[model samples]
Target: MTSSPPGLDLDALRKHLDDALPGLVAGPLDAAVIAGGRSNLTYTVTDGATTWVVRRPPLGHVLATAHDMGREHRVMAALRGTAVPVPAMVHLCSDPDVLGAPFYVMEHVDGAVLRDPESLRALGPERVRNLAFRLMDTLAALHAVDPAGVGLSDFGRPDGFNARQVSRWRRQLDGSRSRELPGIDALHERLAATAPELSAASIVHGDFRLDNTVIDTGRGDRVAAVLDWEMSTLGDPLADLGLYVVYLGTPMPAARGSHDPVTTVPGHPATGELISFYAEKSGRDVGGLGWYTAMSAFKLAVILEGVHYRYTQGKTVGAGFDTIGARVQPLVDRGLAALPREKG
Candidate 1:
């Protein structure tokens, strides 16, 4: 588990906000960096009474195109009528004069991203299963949402998404200093050969899974909000489905290995169960998802390799520093295996 950043003073935030907004009650705000997450610096802020969450770029060198808080805010606003639950977006400050970089404020959702064993015990097996199912349902709901209805017809193009994805990621990986990974190339070729048929354009939560979703574990463990829109884009929704299966099914154990054996995965749901649950909820066929899974595996490998590269270059923050970055090879291998074999 990652710890919040230390030494953040509320007085500084209060001063900054009061100077920026003028009349709105700002703070006696306490800012704590929520750890375990990469890509953004998430802080829990309070205005002496009401609480809000703010996200900004991490303290490091970032690509000019990445970490667009404006894109995040806009997506949240456009997803209003969608079945995906999103916290009410409060304010967006692009002017660096406010917080040193672009940032946004939104209604702080009360829930857990980290799994609590005790809390899981209270929720019991049925509710725990419900929690897992709800996440799948929400993703399906997001797919069902019409981008036109939400003023997002231009959000992204789903046309030829599967066909285009192969080249796009390969290009990104190729530009980096990392050695040519066969698994990545192999998976890319396989996906290109067996790309699935495209479907309707839907809101693709680039990252969606248990941790990205805030499940209100009260009487009913409902997903309060699907957070993290930094990578959200319009494209094939199956790509999203494929990612959930990879993280929940393939990556977790492969990530842990035999390093720790006593770990109990609560509700302890597996990938097949969740994917099936999603298919039922979304009314989509699951028979032809090999490409999606393979795509997910290659995508994760590229992402982790990028993390490895950034860490090696000393461009990332402390918690992101890990030997896990070195494991990109196995991810690629597994991803390649996930794809369907070509017919002879």
Candidate 2:
């Protein structure tokens, strides 16, 4: 018999699912926590015949605006017929009584989430190159989506999105402040002082990256589904592109051990190529990306800092968090460097 993972009540979950869907569970539900997520706690729940993925907030110290289950559910549900690939949202439980926090269930997508250089290498250079381009194309397709058409016109305030992002992330950093993050404040100040004008409002995946997507390895390495939509909203599309570039450039510390930076992987397209490809595919001007990239760095740093805060409070549910705090400063440094110099 398998015991329930921390923060998830299997018996209660089984009851809720059955009550909501009726005859969804055929046997006793068993669940195991899935690794890789640093913010939300993800689990794979099964009842012998079927499996599903459950997403909920961190056990403790969750930021007010982050980790919203309803927002995630709504965006994915709205994007079902769009070019963006998202898991089929099954049920969204707003009542926290069922789970300690609001949680949502979606069909388990079968594919690979390539996180490390080794995994990309396994696919060989040609496949890796093709996969990288496809990921960019997918991102273009997402930015091309009309939020109002998808019932998400009010998903987020697009006007002044960048300015609000700077303020919002600064507040987020304040909420998660446990230790002094050198240059982080300065980076934020620079971002605030030089916030770029909105460069086209569209649906932005707040945390878009290659790892957040599931690749259908059996189907020519195509993206099967895009996961982790907690931060999806209407905003400047360049913000999404900027964050993707940061992920490509940054060397993320693995949970167990470090791997080569994503850019070092064989056949991975250069940053310039990917940016140009997006511009051509999306027809959005790629100018002034430095500001967006710097802002993305600051945003990412705050996110990691929040995770660090949770880890310090023993609220985190998995490995890899120990190394998260250390990465914050580097991101800050990168952001500062990416900022455009003031006019003389």
Candidate 3:
């Protein structure tokens, strides 16, 4: 029998699955942690004949609303048969006794998620450009999905979504503030003053970036599956676009040692190209993007601060946590810069 990894109880998991899933685990189990996700713990498990991915909240320093397993599972399950690719959901376990927290299992997708500039560059310019086009198109496809048709009509509140996001992230920042963060409040206030009217609401992947997806390199334009849906909800679609642009502009530090630099990678589509493509593909106006991008930067700064908080508490369990806090200020500065110059 393979001994359980830290944070996973293999014996209990096997037993629970045997009882809950029936023949899902036919033999001894082995599991290895999947790094890169700072908010959740992901593991790959195999039982001699089959493989699956498991997602659970981080060991400690829990943010109850941010790392919800059920929300992640439900969105993916609802997205099946849609143009947006997502993993096949297998089972959801809510009993904390089985694994010390609720967790879910899904079919393991086989593809690469290029997170850095080097990895993307190795794919050649033409292929990287195609990947970029596909990335934006996929976001358009996701925005086109009807939540009611997919049984997710209640996934999130769409009314006043943009204003709520600003307030919500400020509350999150307040919870994780350890040191002085200049310009964050000013950025948030400006965002509030110029909150865009909700043109239309759709499913928003709170975090949408290159590394958040799996790609079939051979196909170039195919997105095998979109991963990390813990922050997904029914909300303003441009919020997703703004966050994507923010990620493109702000490359995470190499010292933090996660994935490669996305967007900044040579051959990746320019930010203008992405915005134009999204506008053309989704048929949505791009006029309010500046405000959204500022909001995205503010949101990301708060998120990194939370990660830094976990790192300080010794709750994080991977490389790069020590340097993550350093990335917050630059994001805050960028948010300040991205704020809308003209009144909306």
Candidate 4:
């Protein structure tokens, strides 16, 4: 008899699965929290012989238009055979009565999530470099997928996407302003004033990075699955690349016990090289990334602010949240520094 993890009711989940997916639960359920996710709450649940991953919103202070279960399920379900590898969706429970919040279950992907420099270093430089390029190639493949072809023509509005991102993140900042974030407002204003024209619209994974994916080291360092699609939408593809670079540049705080940034690892490709490779692979202009990088920083800063707010309210579900607040200001500064000298 295993006790349920926080924010998940094992009995409720078991009952729902029994009703919706008959005979799926062979035995009583056991669940545990999956760390490393700073935004959505992820859990691994097992019923003796079978296992699956479950994603749900945070406990309290969930922002509007965020942590959408249906959106996450739809995009992944539609991308089953595409070049972009995603976990197989099992079921989506929108009836909050099951988990107190909408949640979806998916097959548990088996692979390594190279989140720290030490993990990347262990692979030696060659494998690390291959993995990085594979990531870039995967992003390009995702960008190459046509929305209308995948029945996602209405996934999002691509026109004025950058402008909407600026306004949306600003509103997100407002929704979670527990403390003053210096330079955040100025960054937002700068982003609003200089939002670039779309550099080509594609299925943008709002948070694209190495850790956000599961690498199948057994398969010659192939990407087994790309996780964390909570922010996926039809928008500027450069936005994904910009955030990927930001992750490469930014390291987690020491207090959080995370290792150095992945960029410092030997064999990791240079930022410029990766960007150029994406340009060559995707056939889209990679110019004017400076503005896109700044926009990514602003978006990340607001996201961390939301997490910090939830931590303050004691609504966060896992560890590593104490230091999240410390990362917000630096992101704000990065956004300001990366802004183009002249608006595009």
Better of 3 and 4 by TM-score: 4
Task: List where candidate 2 sits over 4 angstroms from the true fold.
Answer: 253-258
Report the C-alpha lDDT of model 1 over 231-285, residue by residue, as the tens digit: 7778888889988777665333222233321124456566677778888888888
Clash count of each predicted structure = 0, 0, 4, 0
Decreasing TM-score order of the candidates: 2, 4, 3, 1
True-vs-predicted CA distance for residue 216, candidate 4, Å: 1.0
Candidate with top TM-score is 2
lDDT of each: 0.71, 0.90, 0.87, 0.90
Instruction: Judge candidate 4 at residue 299 and give its lDDT.
Output: 91
lDDT of 4 at 255: 25
Per-residue lDDT of 1-344 in model 2, one digit per residue for the tens?
67889999998898898899998789998998988888888999999999999999989898897989999999999999899999998999999999889999999999998877878888998999999999999999999999989999999999999999999999999999998878888898899999978899999999998889999999999999999988988999999999998988887545234455787878998999999999999999988999999999999999999988988889888777888888889899999999876679
lDDT of 3 by residue, 275-310 (tens): 999999999998878888899999999999999998
> Candidate 4: which pairs clash?
none
Each model's TM-score, in the order given? 0.85, 0.98, 0.95, 0.97
List of clashing residue pairs for candidate 2: none
For every candidate, C-alpha RMSD to the true structure in Å:
4.0, 1.1, 2.1, 1.8
| Least well predicted 10-residue stretch by lDDT in candidate 2 | 251-260
Cα-based RMSD of candidate 1: 4.0
Better of 2 and 4 by TM-score: 2
